[model samples]
Target: MKYQKVLIVLLTICFTGWVSLSCHTNESGGGELNDGLIGYWKLDGDGIDYSGNNLHAELIRSRKRPDSGSTNDTEHNDAWHQVSASSNLKMDDDFSISVWIDALSPDRDVSGDIISQYDVGRRKGFHLSLTTNPSPTGVGNSRRLSFGMDNNIASEWMDCGRPGQALLAFGLAEYNGDLYASTCEPEAGGAGHVYRYDSENNTWKDCGAPDRSNTVFALTEYKGALYAATGKYRVAGSSLPESENTQIGGRIFRYEGAENWVECGQLPGVEAIMGLVVYQGELYASSLYSPGLFKYEADNTWTRCSTPDGKRIQSFGVYDGHLFATSYDLGHVYRFDGTEWVDCDQVGQNNTQTYGFSVYQGELYVSSWPSGKVYAYEDIKQWRDVGRLGEELEVMGLIVYNGQLLGGTLPMAEAYRYQGDTTWQRMDQLDTTENVKYRRAWTMTEHAGRVYCSTLPSGHIYAYKAGETVAWRKSFPEGWHHVVVSKSANKLSLYVGGELVDQKSIPTSDSYHLSSGSPFNIGFGQHDVFQGRIKELRMYNRVLTKHQIDVLGSPD
Candidate 1:
């Protein structure tokens, strides 16, 4: 009851041997749960993995022990990660990643050795970590970057101290002379310093505003830009401040150039902005304490994208031509197809994990939290349990490149790549992992016989050419949300939204340039199966001019 600001209840009713998704549809007025369950025949269908009583019993047991502090409760927390076995989780020119999480610990004391200790003396709940690779210590240590609640106030903890360090929030990024400071623990300096590793020089440098008191709760890179939201005030290297004023406010900011972290936008009505993403050429922000999603247009404006039925969004990802967001309340996955949002949790038989999501090889892949199992779904309303991976590894970001599905893990900066069926390869062997710790490949792009993966928190980019062991890396001027590589007769063209951002040309033989596939396999490479949606797909065997590319953006 401490933080139950919103309650989302989903009920199941059985009437006349029929399983209804609603207990009292008229009373709730939330709409029908399942319209296809009206009539029931004998249990017979294709691609339906019915575990009979076993799955049913597991679900029942989970519901009965909802208050248990076991990992099972957290395993199913809808904060899981995803990986692909084939192609990358491709998004339409626009997409967003949304996630909801129930914070487990508000205090930094986790009953373990103090590898890192820089607490801002606030309530730091749900710490999210980020680090640089090759590690500053040169032994591949996890330079974790975690975001948590400090003193009932949302703050961030940088693991620059150790594998699991907790640094307190000193201040916010402001343009004026005075830096934003916490009301409590005024002795600590505002504008906390974050270390961004310069891979070329192999050294850590202080980035972000120095000597400010703005607390950035959530950070994301959208459309070649870095965005952060301010929430909950607390002093660095301390505990929860006793003032209610520092514990109850929120704001949003975006980094301009390299040092000036200015306020770009704000979540007006929402209580706390948890996540931000760029979908369908527009920016989307998710609020953990609210049921709706907001979008930012090209003209720099925000609007509510859609309102869910009181479900808290845990995480969001864009695949194929639709937008997918996970719900923490009842393991529901919602898909936005540029229109109304459709509840497709039934895709996983109501037992699906709502945390991790990815789109790979034309299929929507979901990795369940706590449970640590992965499932692939042709449809989000119906999921197919594939198999299990590592135990207790909370899978987060999933990407596919060069015929392999890659996944990012927490606590451990090591990432795994799925090789074919039942084969998992360590991604750290590649040279790219040498410079990134806790690198979540949120954005993956392929162009000119090479795959590009960008890591979060560090904002570094790495490109792996075909048959190459080491990745050619670079730093972005701004964090990029999504990357698109368009090919016109063997020539590579890149575009964001409808504008061309990056491009290159590759020489091709006659066999490579003249090949054509139906439906034009837009999301995942060239595949026959249509697992995801195709918004606007066009393939040309012959080279098209710049005018033609513009026409593709607007068909006549």
Candidate 2:
């Protein structure tokens, strides 16, 4: 009888150990590290959660097919997988997401979301994606992998002081992790000098004027160097008083450090350089008053490229494998294919100019003048109205920040965030200078983790740190790359290819209760629809340790 009792106890102990081992063992080789794993999608052929959990995701197409040139492929544009909201998928505490991505059409002008479960209306949840938008504080190689969270609160704007006696902070750029601004100072003997922002002291350090021009019109980064374009801006164009300085300016200069710039030659027959961008691997510039687009060559030479409908192009952006240019003539957006230009036609019936471009929620969006409204690109020449900024005449800077699309407006100099379905929420009036005919929140850029906006009349820069974002400030490499986003305790960390790349601290008051009832998106979110292939997606209800993450990121 004693032997029988002992044998029964031993059998029970063995069975309990076997069950525990089965629960902890991961088929992917992370032994005893599968605790709190809620979902695991291999995405080999379908969205089946192979972790013995029945959280299957449904693939859905969010946009209608084009009337012509449809491929009818299963993974077409706007196609993404959706997992229904469930209690287990609701990350109300610590969580981790790991996935592998292979971007298909990676362009310098485009960005797309990888995975997210964010609600733009309520302003809550988390988002992870690739970002390539321009910010005021940082300049070159702006493409990065960004992970952000919405804390259900908007940050107040911080004043970064004005840059000398400048009337307008005409342009902003980020270069080598530093923030620089170009100004428009039309006073006699006051040229438009480039100033670097001193964050530690809340001041501006003059980097000297590149030319005897009223405005340092544009800034860009190419080949690991900072470049500035000059312009003789006429303040009377904005209904402001005419300047005493009238020097002709269409010069380009390369930064050689503090208070020094090297001339890179000037554009012939061009009085002002309106825009500058680095497309593909070359530098391109546009003329403000002439119908010309010039490409930089070796040894201070520039070759003029074919113009779109002989129209003047003012601002430039890249998307969908083509270089897109906004027109200063007919409110048209054009696409360039190196040899020729294809006009996308006018954006709105009444608007006469398109100012800037931004990517939001898997689509291209542009801001317009006269109407002061924003429009989303539906197809070639097809635009959907996205409402107008309140009582504003022109919208200039369009950028994506903190999982939301934001635009800066003229006249009122206000900023607004896009909610869903043509709704916009006013954020703040950046410039409060009164008795001015036009106050502009002119240019913007992102640096460090904050969105900075430069204002006209005041020339003061305002910064907003919305939520928390950690960005890998380099171009996402080609082929497949491993990415991990982990929110543990009060810290959020990003790991790329099994190495820690960037991190940011969550507010102590943040509960991080990401219980937004929105569906978990796999290849789409609040940004452009993902233009890539995703596989081996895993979500854990608990934070993943570095060792466990490294093992998963390793090759088989």
Candidate 3:
């Protein structure tokens, strides 16, 4: 229930619910093909491209998360990075290339190119991939399906397997010509099945679900057909309370072609419908425990429109033409002005929370929560904040790669790259974990020049293209060393003067996550305190082992 595949990886929206991030478009891209989207890259370790058309891609051997990259060190694959450069690239057919493949060793079978645009002798394009279908004990990968696609030159490869409890492919769509995905199994009673790959009989079907919600998360396309969105039903590890998150409420289905599909209703008892948008022409949907934004109109019907129920609308965007969003409730950011949804005022304060939504050149950018910053917006009200990824980071998805903006962060599942509109640049680290149990870096893609991310628990796959060498950091030990820190309720520790250095497992909140109930006083907050003074101090509510602070001698 902890993952970080693709490049900025990071997933575990509180475990149990399997692989996360339901679409994401810019609103940055949750896949309905971001128009001329081009080589987006979100891999941050830089492969260039930024979509301006430079088309970068190249990193073959990647590494980052070295020194304190410590996630208890299960570390095996060594390190990887390779944002493709060219198999000709330039793609079209409506585009649609999603990534975030962190699958270290479900026993192995495939996975090396998170977003490949093949030439295969001209059969050409497509490769959003992952593997694990062979078994006898050699490869069943928890159960199966780790996200698949290869039609064109790879001969034929249309995967959509995730069985053994499930967790793969959070979002990707090309509609009708085939290529729709949005799963996340986690051993439940149903909600996880949106496969469909047939890019010309390459095969793979399923294409169903969403009555009691097996977990469809999201799958775009809008005005013509393909439109999915549902919630609740995970069961694998567990986490349901939002009054059951959905008794069949927040749904939305449409497809109707091969395996059929239908439904298109829901949103009354509402508990989770995450995000979806088609803008001006039609289709809307978004919510989380009754938040707001529902439109659709005919067929199964829908109406609400604006927002106000409880607030939770996580992501959405569309610049210049209008409709912008971001809200984990208080982190606000609104903008829909043709009639309602105003408030462009919040960014991170009440517990942080606003989430990733992208729009580069035309403005709009989000991804919030205390130290993991990333604001931008512009008119209706203003909001800049810009740059961040440390004070306990938590950015989850965004894309505009190659020409700028690229983000994804959560408990260290890094990936940044904005260099301008407000500054940002790291790019890789799906693996080196400080481990806050790795939660939500969900999805942010850009196929062709490579740039994909789909992380959750360690399900890795990072690529950012073009010659590299960065990864070094983890040095420490310079001089004036006399530090000590500790925490409990699952653990966290560190020391320098008395030795010990580092420790892990704080699972979900602690280590003085800084809200300040007070007392650890030195110079007192602000400059980070104790530049030189502090003759003595001690505070112990509990958790002080190491022989109880080493017999307390140093304080003398």
Q: Whole-model Cα lDDT per candidate?
A: 0.35, 0.80, 0.45
Predicted structure with the largest TM-score when compared to the true one:
2
1-556 per-residue lDDT for model 3 (tens digits): 2333432343334342342333222212323333344444444444455555555544332222122122211111223223434332433222222222233322111222233323222222232222111110001111111111122211111122332233444554444333455565534353556665442443446665555554666666654456777776333322222222234546787777755778868777665576776555566777755567777888677887656444656566544345666776667777674457667777745435676565443344677765688776655456667778654467767764333346777766676666653457675565453434544455654332334455554433344531101111121212232333444455445444555544444334212222111111112111110111121122223344443344332433
The estimated TM-scores of all candidates read 0.44, 0.88, 0.27
Better of 1 and 3 by TM-score: 1
Choose 1 or 2, whichever is better by TM-score: 2
lDDT pick, better of 1 and 2:
2
Candidates in descending TM-score order:
2, 1, 3
**Poorly placed runs, candidate 3 (over 4 Å):** 1-190, 193-272, 275-312, 315-332, 335-342, 345-380, 385-406, 409-414, 417-421, 426-556
RMSD of 1: 23.3
RMSD for all candidates, in order, please. Answer: 23.3, 6.3, 26.0
Give me the overall lDDT of model 2: 0.80
Cα deviation in Å at residue 434, candidate 2? Answer: 2.2
> Which parts of model 2 are misplaced by more than 4 Å?
1-28, 62-78, 103-109, 134-141, 256-260
